[model samples]
Target: MKRFQVFAIIILTGAMLLVASCFWPKDNIVVGERIIRFIPKEEILDFKVKDNTQNVDSVIAMLESRAYGINEKAIRRNSILDESVFSESDYFVNPKSDGGGTALDNFFRYLQKSDSSLIRIGHFGDSQIEGDRITSLLRIMFQDKFGGSGVGYVPLDDVTSPVSYTRSSSPNWVRYTVFHNRSAKGLYCPGGTVFRYRFATPESTRDSIGSNGDTIKIKVPACSYSNATVFLKLFRGYSVAKLWYGKATEPAELKVYNSKTNELLAEVVLDSDDPFNVMKLPLKSNPVTLKFVFTGPSPEIYGLSFDPVVGVQFDNYGLRGHSGDGLLTISSDLLKAELIKLNDKLVILQFGGNVTPYVKNEASLNNIKNSYDRLYQHFRKAMPDASVLVIGVNDVARSVGGTYASYPMVSRIRDAQKEVALKNGCAFFDLYQLMGGENSVLAWNKKGWASRDGHYSDKGREIVVNELYLAIMGEYNKFLIHGTTAGK
Candidate 1:
């Protein structure tokens, strides 16, 4: 009898706990650092095909319509060098704004007159391009068609994974940027970040300069190019710099190795008295690792650019958590100096994704719009000759009632971005609409094209980039045919 009574009490306790768990105060509960949410009991397990098929169909039709006038056979014959194959308009420009010409027109002009000078495109984005995924592919596409050699700008300290190049540095190196580190104050260049290497002890007390300084190794993959130019933008307080190339296990000594044959190519000593210096080295072949050993006062290194004399150089200036507002923080003089050095012809701003989640109402939306306006104005004032292109936010979905749906405020944020672009005489690309509006992320997730809530999978990225390429080339082709006679 006593055993039966104890069993009844145990069942009652279990029932009580289950009932309490189901009746929480909020829909989502915070346990530790993670938010635990209750799933709806009647959630749909299977994917429901939303009625947005027309959106994608319309995009395809637009691409097809743009290809109607071109000679398909001739394009096929010389597709490698032909830009017409990619001509399709996926961008919008304001009807009444006088920045003079379209960004695409400016870029086309640069492409035509790139023999004497190098034309550079600065692609600034957030985590969408963290590992050089999108930027590297774009670089290859541009370089292949535009007759350029060498990888473009690489930051002094790589914060994200690199696809084309491998960079490893000593542990003593420190990174400073305009975004994250509040205490770090100074004039940042167009890249918005810089790296510095300092000795633990005073340089005077160091036993040996080579033994105490930091060493950085950059390995380039094998390719047809046999020469590379290292462009360095230096800040104050730099003395002697040594560059060694070739296969060497030791980091203390400088060894000359053949850049082509991977044999010790050459040894060069650099003096850091100027703000900017370009060091050119002849490589025996591609696939070479260059080691830079520096010892002296700490030097603020902007970036190391490897590029040929004349070609399209796409510089990836991606800052992980920036909302495009940080550009205003950089002094205009410093920003213009770097842009002038690069001969920046086009500036692509890929933001809005980082600022989407916090936009709850009209006030928040206005704040973002104002911030973008300031950023656009800053870029315009700094680079009057350069064109600006703003890419809108991608589709981000959150779980609602156990099913993934687009955030309610995404459209508002995108509209705000469009307003800012129009107001600043900039071109706007609707990434959200291009991805397929309204629950498109859910469809992408269903098809395994999205990795998580909103981030694209490899396949998804390829699709989006292909479309973007078509859009850019399409506009460029229109500019070629119309020759600025038509309104933007």
Candidate 2:
């Protein structure tokens, strides 16, 4: 009896182990354990037979049934060229410069000679960059390398997730979706503004230069929404002074005799209730910590440009579920305004993560291309001097044949993006290919880099950052070489 019991126990233990192995949850999937196995799409060959005419129909039907909606033929060949070619004035007009080489490099080359304190970067996308997923990492990296401060153009009030900038309270705000052309006017506390928020209160800060004197010189950034009013307030025993403004406003030139002996304060304000509202503030004061304020009605504001900087940095204008088309239709004027500020600036267009799952046919693929083309056209019109860089869709996962497969539509989108980028004098980055071609998401999941909670895990984001950082760095290096050698 004891020997029989021991045998049964051993068998039971073995069965339990098998069950546990079979029921384990996938690393990055939100599905339950039993449905989380890695069943390759190729292994699920469950097609059927029929008559001759039915046979062709069957094949097409089967392919479509298996998520083969991608128009493999629609993809264009890569045409981006080396930065050296961009130096020729004729090269700029050449139809071919529109594609190929790293898009990031093309944009940077435009800013190499600019006197701005920081180069401005805009990362527009769907849900990926929300809460600073990809944009935050890019900001830290870029700002560290370049010189800038203040989280660039964040919405006045954020409801979807907590922004890294100033926190908000009260639910009485209204929300608007640039994608659907919908506004939460009737709803309670929409929590979003249709326009950029501009502050009116004067902001004070210590002069980077020793403020032993009364006058400080500052420059106003070349920005959109030039129609703005800045209010300078004197504080901390600081007296009021005559204010001057300019694209190159300098605080060092302020005329004050022994004014530095007494404490003085200055308040600057750029007032606007429209989107794309950006203005620069230039002030001169004694070397003390300064306070800067922007006062406004109902919390509508825009971009603030400070003196002593040559370039603008990261501006987080990412909207959830935004298809990049909303701006074209809903806020064309505002977008145009923003583009004006960015004239001769760098525009990084990041998208494709949201459209991958919805693509179903060639028509859909073409439609997406057209949509992007429109978006690109508007951007071009707004910032004719700036360069545009379109990043192909990143690696993402989809369920196929009862298991997740790296959707092939990603490639189709990349191809489409490349074609569009090249056609419009823009640059393209094959983000999907950069992340390891097909099914890289699976590796990310298996390696525990991604979380099973749907969105990318923190680890997964880091991995993405690593790859993107390399790509951007390489592109920047190319710009340096070409700018020094070719004069592009």
Candidate 3:
């Protein structure tokens, strides 16, 4: 009888604790504008739209239908020529087909010439390609096939720590960007970020370097490149600069070092008054470091360009947290002149992921499309000869009803991007579908291919980039076969 009474008391205590826990104050977590609270089921459901589930389902269906043409077999194919399946909407050919040839046809013709001139490909994107993830793989593959030797463009003051190269600058260097809390003066060039070294006046002097000098160092990884070119601009007020390239331990001097050994290679001083200058220097071997010492007035630096004398160069112009519209901040004339100088043949714009989270309705979607269309038109104006390829947003997921599901807005953003690309006569790669369409992030996450927060894992990146490479090569192969005929 006493044991039964004790058991009843224990059960009553447990029930009391459960009731008290329900009444306890809950912590609210804010994500974007939504506040999340661990509350009663009724209260949580009340905060969500009544048709949210149906809307997500409808968007998923649409995405699935659109992705039906993604040839999984072609993506997995080993040989480029054997991969033939591709949707017409997957990549739009310029309808006008300048000079009786498509944009890609022209590129292929250039590739066949085997000339000494470089074929530059400018790849601009948001954080998706930051840190040289996708661009680095593409660069290696292209260089391996086409005979290029160095990693392409490396920004001056990069926020995204690039794995391809090591860059460190003195804290005194000032970084300026074209978009998002923009710089107060000077225009941004094709390479989204620029660096400036300002000298402190007598009253503002803080560092021992004084009012006249600063230094920055760039070190290529152990096996990346043997040569590099530093792109600089001497503004009206700036003066001369010196470049020192060599092994990390070697003294800075103009001398020849063994090509296979890491030693001091060479040094040069630029006293030119030209507004823009390209300083090309050879490195002793792969994994060489270059130091720049500015001894006079401040100079505006664009970035470093690294590539071989021949073959294709892929430049990664990745800006974090950017929508495509930031390109508009740069002057059209400057952008055009830079493109012409770079000999850019192909321009890839990968964006829309950053804008997806804010997409709430049709009007918002249209706004994104309109913004992208304007950007596309600007690129066409800037480089009419270049072929533009727009890569759509990747799959992003959000937690809904205690389960992670694909963000419903991602499909709409993808659709808008496709429309913009087609309307602008540019090719479109549906990266969202290539990532396996709606709710595919879950699978990727489960396979350790993507982070729970939605960014791709290293393995996931390889899988997606490989598929993209196949698609690009497939198009190139098609061009190789028909380009000559079309030109005639």
Candidate 4:
């Protein structure tokens, strides 16, 4: 065909496609885990995605220069990074009504004189903060200043390898969670997980020898008679340590040993049939590594805590793909009991982002907001004295002809979050606005802070954590200056 004939054919095809776009369905199609959108004629020409990243390498490069220098004798820098990102989000949404708008007041007051008290902060969210991505840094930011040692809570089978320490369990242990099945039973741990172990007996190789000088081989039963061990290495000194487990249906023996020295730390016989129990280890010195050996019928190990009775600790209980409403799965009484026992002081909830795809319109958004409100109400009942901090969803990008922009419903979600938070007497942090409003995800992706315009990268988490630290410190400083009436 001639060049003019080819050009005419291409133009005709393009025109046909453009005209046919008008008939496409307006509603987004949901496929498995993705929302497929069909573009209409009106939005066919808009290429609005912008590069919004800022180069702050020089200003924040020195943030994560070193690791947390943990020492029980002396106070060191709280965290590796102490610099602020100077984000557009300047303050939290704590409204005043009749001079009673103190949202984070309880938490701030605790931080003011935290030297003698136990302050536990629970950082709960979806995969964004998984594997201790965001909570580890925040724990560092507060622990040294508040006088704490040890990592907070380590579940029996922490699907994500944590950042602060190493935890290895026996292969025979089975893990269960409420994320996939919201109506899951049993007393779930704060991490939304629970572990079960079939009782095992030690290999009787030494005892299998016969008196007639005959040698016999013994095969340890995989399910009922194999030695299973749980190993923990903190790499640093921790003044306190404890283990949490469920009812000991049968008599079991737990032997705690110092892996480095082979020294026997403690041996306990667990036969109590209580629904829950705490085994506090007797640590003579700040040991770095320990091993747990289980023999006989084992109880359900809920989680472990390597923390002090007095100081600050943040537990990372991130549930991937959770919409903040999954907390209802765990028995409310059990949940409240766990929080009260932990002495939980603050609960920082980072949600909305995970559920945005499910919310397409006003009713869905409102449903999410109501869900969050219910979540906070449950939390209040669980930890009456604890303060809750609601972080609005960060910017999420949607493409329009290759132009990426914030989801249209993001602002509405943020507004709903703020409104509900203030109404429920919880502190609200406008994280969506904090990242420069609309194109923030794109900007973060441009700076390599977030991967795929959503999940945060290392640099992305750092800047975000830095901003949060600055915000918390800002409020704490005000509390220091103005006392409890700072809001006035």
Candidate 5:
């Protein structure tokens, strides 16, 4: 109860600050007209949080541990892949294909072919995916099974980039996103955020409030957003590092150095050839402390991808406090410009938890379906080649009298989500059902896998994503067995 009071006090304090602030965007969290956006930590706060080695090695062990069902020793390869005969977690319902193959045939085929090409899976979601919780495990599993390395596609200024690596940017670097700043003029990367040096124009900003410890920064003007340096501390190194960006108005100096030793690794003069540009650096040494110094002109810095020449890479784009509706504002041209060049295969859309608290009537329910359908059409136009999978809203619990229970409207939203996925020829995964339906979160909380707030704890996420992995592999197994699900 004291923790609740402290949080409430913080909220009240933020609200007071929001009232005084001249300008702020209403993107992510909207609580009774005040923005309750959970801001990402700036690189300056890097020392505050511990990192290095929590993801890769640890996650690999969990994957092989036989957590949910099949044991690695008994299954070897065939038993784990035998979803039809062995696995019980079957919530994935895919979009109908053109009759010859299933919707994910192209994705599965790529996995089967053993190509060295990087298979990109963009996982888009709400706060549930922040801090690279669920997606990190997926990256390690895919990379281990198929072959790949490095965390893929992190925003230039990320609040939840990935705990696997430690990153700090110059405080002058301010972030603009589809949900964050409405007045800022810039296109968003797949992560829903684009960054600029402090020089960029803006009305006002809400920098990470109180997250820097006890002090809430209510007003930060356009000229000076932060004061920090750019450096990446990798727990594990990658052979290839690719930096993605939009056009630069002038040539910029992007020099790479070993942050600890200050030894120059590579130096490059950057100017975009087209609307989108990527600078691939072949690292000879995996420096423990790598620093990036960008000077001169600020490009529309999208994010960086650390991957090998071959295997699968999954990018986590978590847009907090949003229903899936925010995609309507994301420009298709911008998305295509950044993504069209990649060997993109699958796009996972996980959402609807943020919308549960707002459901009051039937109109709100229809809004969910309509917005999703529109977003689907827009996303398809943006990246037409990729297979789309919609993971329905997970179970949401609310306080009733004293104890917590499932919200009455969760099933309605899940139904709408399933409908949208089916209607649009997108694959559907019934996360609500997989979570054991209504009030399952209560049980999850009992097991320390869930909180009353609806987000999954670390242990719970491992199990949640484990099922998702099996479901995808199950389809692949069928593909391997049947050859094709397309019409004859």
Candidate 6:
């Protein structure tokens, strides 16, 4: 009886093992591939191969030839040939194609050329540029290397609930956004006067104030107007106006005196916008502080000019959840306008950070490159004369057999990005290799350059930006001094 029981137990255990084998799932994480979906139709249409580079030997050559010829034909027919499997990231989304070398050199020449008296370099990125981390550092470096001053654009006010700038106050005004989905009741205002009629004071008498550390400025003609005039008034300060009539022989002087104490503050003559005027004011304090006391019928305030130069660099155009879709999504008109505002525009498209987290198959991966094509077209249209660069994904690793291994497919995604840039005449910088080959981010995390698992630490970010800057500067110098070594 004991023997019979033993046999039955063995039989039951074997049956259970068989069932488990049939039903249980296997681990699916691939080691090196990027998380990109290769949409077959889109891939063919976007990554066509060109004929000129048909016989080149390197990986870059083969990839370019295949992409230009195949992608071009596919685009023409409104079709794609992406049979490649999806990988781990979107680094290849909107990869460049064709005219890389010439595109790069021309962009460098543009940067070196000084068009504006005070050149402006606008570096727009997600949170990376926020608080002027990379932008500030880059600005200082560039200004030292090149020449420019004054922080180009500044938020008249900052409204982050957490507060990210140098100084912090309880609450100045409320904040509102046209692009972001949020609204405030207090003295909130959208980015610029962009979304008309949205500016207001929290309460009727509420006031919000901020300061630029050691920087002090006072407007000579506090009360001023321009183009269209509307009734205006000023409080808590002095004002002045100046005028030039048929080129006056001697500079005319007008003075403002305190009615009670009879304190002399400034001397000038009030002038009109229809006629240009220059006014000067003498401030009692070393750091000048004067408020506008205006009673005018003008729509514009003309006399509020400050020194054309200031400190710090800022570029905050990073989109957190975006997948190389930012350029494609921003309106053509708005993008063009912003590009025009930048003195030496440097566009760096960094992606694939999000794509690594989730991806399932090959076809999806190839289709991911289609997004790169969209990005290329959008950028070309938005900033026809701007310098564009691409930063591919860093090395990401996955756990395999009790250890982390670099997935083989990562190379494919890198190739895709390079091909796209080369084809589209844009410059591509390999962040993956720069960060130290496959699984480098893991090392960066170990060095505390990266956060606990993902994301970069302050130090890590600095390192990344420095490398980028060096690479960028190297290219710029090569082009500027060498003179058109590469053909378009």
Cα lDDT of all candidates, in order? 0.62, 0.49, 0.62, 0.71, 0.71, 0.43
* C-alpha RMSD (angstroms) for model 5: 11.0
**Candidate with more favorable, higher TM-score: 3 or 6:** 3
Q: What is the lDDT of residue 294 in candidate 1?
A: 48
Candidate 6 minimal-lDDT segment of 10 residues: 188-197
For candidate 1, the 10 contiguous residues with the lowest summed lDDT are 235-244
Model 3: how far is 33 from its true place, Å? Answer: 18
Which runs in model 5 stand beyond 4 Å of their true positions?
A: 1-88, 199-228, 485-488
Off by over 4 Å in 2: 1-106, 113-116, 180-276, 279-308, 330-333, 342-344, 451-455, 484-488
Tens digit per residue, CA lDDT, model 2, 128-234: 66755676666666554554444454453454563443333222333355564354331111111253222232333433333543334454333332122222222
> Residue by residue across 228-277, what tens digits does model 1's lDDT show?
22322221111112221111122222233433344554554444444443
Residues 1-488, candidate 4, lDDT per residue (tens digit)?
A: 34576679999987887777877667767889998776677667555554544433332343334232233343222322222312223546554433453666777767655677778899999888887789888887787567787778877666677777788888777677777643234657766777767654345343366565455566764345365688988844566778787777788777888999988888778776765666787755557788888777767677778887677988888877777887777667887777777777898888888777667898998898898888877776677666788888888877655466677788888888888877877777887766666666776676677864478887778777867876666555454444532442
Global Cα lDDT for candidate 2: 0.49
Candidate 5 residue 159 Cα shift, in angstroms, is 3.0
lDDT of 3 by residue, 1-488 (tens): 34567679999976775575477556656789998665444443355422222323443344334432244443432234442454223423333354666545555666654356788888898877887778887776776566576667766566767767766655455678776657554456585666655444122323333233443233423222222222222111111122211111222222333333435555444354433445565543433345544433445556666666776778888888888687888778878877887788888898877887888888988888899989988888888766777888888887675466777889889888877776776767777776567776666676677774567778777766666765666566566545432311
TM-score of each: 0.73, 0.57, 0.70, 0.76, 0.79, 0.51
Stronger candidate by lDDT (1 vs 2): 1
**Ten residues in a row with the worst lDDT in model 5?**
49-58
Please give me the total number of clashing residue pairs in predicted model 2. 69
Task: Please give, for residues 1-488, the per-residue lDDT of candidate 5 as tens digits.
Answer: 24567899999986665454424353556778796753332322234322222223433344346545434443332223454444534577865576556777777777654455777888889899976779998887777667778778766666666667778777677787677674255466776777777445455657453643553546766654322247887665576888777777898767778888888888777787566677796555667578877777687777777777777888888878867666667678867766667667788889889989888689988887788888777766776666788889988887553345678899999999888777766788887776667777766665677786679998888887878887776666666666753311
The digit string of per-residue lDDT tens for model 6 on 150-189 reads 3333332233211222222113222233224332211111
Runs in model 6 with CA error above 4 Å? 1-101, 127-130, 150-152, 155-164, 167-314, 341-344, 396-412, 452-454, 485-488
